[model samples]
Target: MVTERDKELIGALQKGLPLVRRPYAALGERVGMGEQEVLRRLADLRAKGVIRRHGVIVRHHELGYRANAMSVWAIPDERIDDLGEQLAGEPGVTLCYRRRTAPPAWPYNLYCMIHGQDREAVLARRRELAEKYGLDQWAHRVLFSGRRFKQRGAWYRPPQPAPEKAEVRHG
Candidate 1:
């Protein structure tokens, strides 16, 4: 079970650090903690793998990356590791990993995220990758995100009962 402090720390991390010279300190002030304590708790959470990484989540489109696609590749099961590493090392390829292929309807195992300023640029890069890696034989598709519904850090709060005052009193 997470302690109350832990819950607060999770909330803070989920919301994100404030844009300031001493952002943690500002967050700590809001939650009745000091900057050092906040840092300590963050370190502890990361060490335990509760937090994978602490970094900014940028708006790619706002930053002029109008085209972003999830590119899936059908790589041989035996060569996934080597090919995944190679794909990840490529410029503008932000993410790459392997997933179990879905039958009949979906048949891609390897996935990578590619971002560019426009559809043509992204497609051009994909073609370049296809040629460089001899991926023409492998089936692939680029699925662009139609809309962004939720793109925030994980919320780690547990359910709570109604506030005692609200439960007990009537105006």
Candidate 2:
């Protein structure tokens, strides 16, 4: 079970670790913990599913990517996995994942985000992708983004967890 200190550590991590050689040590210093303790706590948090994913998140717009497009496809159920992987490998394809298809309403199961400096360049890449994958025969759409807001990575650190009942055992 998570405690107050665990929550504090998780909350601190939402801002990201320091860009230093001894990042854990820096975190530990801030949290009144030893370096090893911070590492152990982070590992424990991951094991307990408190933290789902750990990685560096880049803000593409800040990095000079002026335009972005979400190219969604109505991929066949059997072909989604292979095609999704192939799309992920393409240059400028920043994000790729599958979603549950809402039949008759929305059939787009495979999705990818392509980023570039120019909208036309992004569209050209999309066309190349479609041609390379023969996506014209399949249903696909490249919706160029006009504006972006709140594109930061998720901050999973909650201030306080909701109350829950846990069974107690006495030895």
Candidate 3:
């Protein structure tokens, strides 16, 4: 069960940690908790499965990776697990995962993202990966992103209150 204080801590987390040498200390100050207390509470939350995991959203363009391509494949269901794992471990592959396919429209199920400084490099890397992993045997497509959307971590919202019980009067 989340206490009121935990909610306060979560609120601070939703704002994103402040960029400082002692970020946890700063975060604790905001939540009216000490650094160690904050850490302990976070650890407890993780142990209890209240918090799943943490991740970073990188700005690839700013980091000189201008070309971004999402290479999707229609791998056979039986072979998808092995191939997805192999492709995910390849160099230049930033992200990889499986998704549900919409047949007759979109048949791609397995997806991997690769970023590079230019389109040629990204495409070449994709081709190499496909040939090296025998991914060319499967139908696939490389879709280059034309624009980037804003990215941020997950947001937490407060739970709504239950409705008050209605009292019925009897004559």
Candidate 4:
């Protein structure tokens, strides 16, 4: 069961947080808890699988990595697990996951994110990955991010109170 304290944390996350050196301490003050209590609860939540992870979200593009691509691969069913782990071990590949491949429509089954200084650099790393994994026989593609819509921390909240509606009167 979700407790009231959980709801409070969720609410704080949804409304966003203040930018300060001790942000958690400020958050604790608002929620009637000390900074250590806040940190302890967060740790407990993670241990119980209530939260996956808490970390900084970096903007790769802002860091001069202009070229970003999602490189996907279709590995033989038997080799998927081994190959995925191998690719994940690569330095430049940040994100890697196994996905279903819809043949004739979608041929890539595994996905990895590669960010680099430019297109040429990204392509070069992709080539290195393909050769390292011996994926010449497998079909693959690099899908670059044309645009980003919404990227922010996940917000957990209950149904919010709706805004007051204006009354309409017929003349």
Q: After superposition, how far is residue 100 of candidate 3 from its true place, in Å?
A: 0.5
lDDT (0 to 1) per candidate: 0.76, 0.77, 0.80, 0.75
lDDT of 2 by residue, 30-144 (tens): 7788998888888997899766557666666788898988888997888889988898899989889897888777788788888898899899998999889887687877888
Q: List where candidate 4 sits over 4 angstroms from the true fold.
A: 14-21, 147-155, 160-171
- Quote the lDDT for 61 in model 1: 77
**1 versus 3: better lDDT goes to:** 3
Candidates in order, TM-scores: namely 0.80, 0.77, 0.80, 0.79
Question: Residue-pair clashes per candidate, as listed?
Answer: 0, 0, 0, 0
Task: Encode model 4's per-residue lDDT on 1-171: one tens digit a residue.
Answer: 556676576556544455789888988887788989888877777788776566555667799999888888888889989988998899888788887778799988888889899988998999998887787678888888887895554433445432222211111
Better of 3 and 4 by TM-score: 3
* TM-score for candidate 3, residues paired by index: 0.80
Count backbone clashes in candidate 1.
0
Q: Mind giving the per-residue lDDT tens digits that candidate 3 earns over 1-171?
A: 888777677767765677899888999997689999998888887888787654454566898999989999999999999999898789999889898889979999988899899999999999999989899798899999986574443345645232122111111
- Lowest-sum lDDT 10-residue window in model 2: 162-171
Candidate 1 TM-score, true structure as reference: 0.80
Q: After superposition, how far is residue 95 of candidate 2 from its true place, in Å?
A: 0.6
Query: Order the candidates by TM-score, highest first — what do you get?
Result: 3, 1, 4, 2
- Judged by TM-score relative to the true structure, which candidate is superior, 2 or 3? 3
